[model samples]
Target: MSAPFRDEEFESAWRELDEPQLEGGWQLFTEAMGVTIYRRYDEETGLYEYKVLGVLTSCAPARCADVYMDLEYRKGWDKYAKELYEKDFSGRSAIYWEVKYPFPLSNRDYVYVRERRDLEVDGRKIWVILARSSPETPWDEKKGVVRVTDYRQSVAMESNGACGTKVSMNYFDNPGGLIPSWLVNWAAQTGVPAFLTDMQKACDAYGDYQLRK
Candidate 1:
């Protein structure tokens, strides 16, 4: 995953996004709080991961992006995050991010490149952002954390003509430790939906949390 943005990995991801789900083969993991979750096996590469699609009725595309890239905002909603920040940026959009997990689990982090683009389809502007984990920056030890390299996530949002956004995310991560498969499955199924709920709530308050000039 050391490749830079727009490289082969990203190119492939862009194409896959056109189809996002693996068609009728993708199993429905859960659907709640307006977020419909799906899962599939990818044992050849990483563990079981989720592909989530839903609508955030309270936010616009810009607000969604703002909440995602703003690390401080995450602290207010992302409960699993013990520590989160971006540093040692690769140019302007790619950077290193560290995440400290909670107790009983090894902390894992990521290096992701943020790619954004706007598409015009049928006279409508659609915005998409993909923040994918890149290994271009070498992994370094953080006293009590385990480095997680196998992580990928992307978001595509299009306005729904009512100020809301239709969003989708393809995310997967491999926690490098002795954790059981069942536990990993449980965490993904439970954590992702909760994350989305918190995200939607945070997005509702984005304007209030805007940084002052």
Candidate 2:
């Protein structure tokens, strides 16, 4: 069970973010906390894919990238995470995450692979992390939880030059179940911004956390 994505795939995703015409099909969904979210209808899944762009006023790009990759630190900040861990799949490591939904809804879990890249395009530094759901995992589905089968997310970050980081993210997923469309859309519009705010808080405290470690 090697990684399903290649380095070229991540590079291509990052390049797409840099393209000026990439926003053509996406419609503005919401704006909050310096982030603007856009959504586009996915014909294949009848779901919406989100594109988020913002400037995080909390930390530098490098620090922000480091915070994102630190699983131990994530456990403390991400309140919605019920179960999160990583295990080796063949020679590659993959993540297992179970997210807590509202009381009446069943929790959703995901098995995914992620990779991070540090790149410099024309002297501007960029940090990119790409993740996608994988079917090759040793875990089995739990009775009380629903497994998310089609999930993909990519984030690109660079310095904003005022001690902040500029971030661009593309996210899509289908939480398998009979959830209403409006509820799904509402969650994306709100949850994504809240997650960014939490991430900034985590980034702001990462230095202290590392010192203690």
Candidate 3:
């Protein structure tokens, strides 16, 4: 019924990343391809929350944000996206996404609400997109699919003058099933960068995709 996440939560996240520090239990995980990632462990859930900062030198901030929010375009580029669509719950809109998993593992799915904001602070333009899981949804769970109950993702973008867009992302999710610790660690260390690389390529191609449409 109400907003999935509070306005203060988004503001706090953006403010913490404004200067970008490694305090508050966040440890540096890896740095590659101009992206720096940090992870924090959740004691109760035994999951990790990741924070990443990078620069996408291929496009402007607004363009990057547009590509990130475009669900139709995502189906073409996102290899893991098996099924994706949007639905309206009462008056609020939510997204349904099913992600592919390796053989012998069930697919993971998510139902969440997302919001995008274009803001100006101190004469600098900023774009932010926030998403979090919604427990109440109209869609019934599909057999053989593991619905992720705990998921949150946020992105903050700003212009980099002549370079491109400076981006920061925070992510966490719990795939409900028996997953090995090694596999989770591997995904965190390797998967984040791989996704970012794919996103950059998608941004570069977005202009042509729009022209065709």
Say which candidate scores most in TM-score: 3
Tens digits of lDDT, candidate 1, 36-73: 78888776865576788778887887778778778777
**Candidate 1, clashing residue pairs?**
none
Model 2: per-residue Cα lDDT over 108-160, one tens digit each: 99998888889988998889999988876777889999999789998888887
Higher-ranked by TM-score: 1 or 3: 3
Candidate 3: residue pairs that collide: none
What is the number of residue pairs that collide in model 1?
Answer: 0
Query: lDDT tens string, model 3, 1-213?
Result: 436567776675566447775788999998887888899999989888999988888788888989999999999999999999998878889899999988888999999889888877788788888998886777789999999979998888887677588888889999989987877876777777788889889999998999999
TM-score per model over all chains: 0.82, 0.93, 0.94
CA lDDT of each prediction against the hidden true structure = 0.69, 0.85, 0.86
> In model 2, where do residues sit more than 4 Å from their true spots?
2-4, 20-24
Model 3 TM: 0.94
Flag the better candidate by TM-score, 1 or 2: 2
The lowest-lDDT stretch of 10 consecutive residues in candidate 3 is 9-18
On lDDT, the stronger of 2 and 3 is 3
TM-score of 2: 0.93
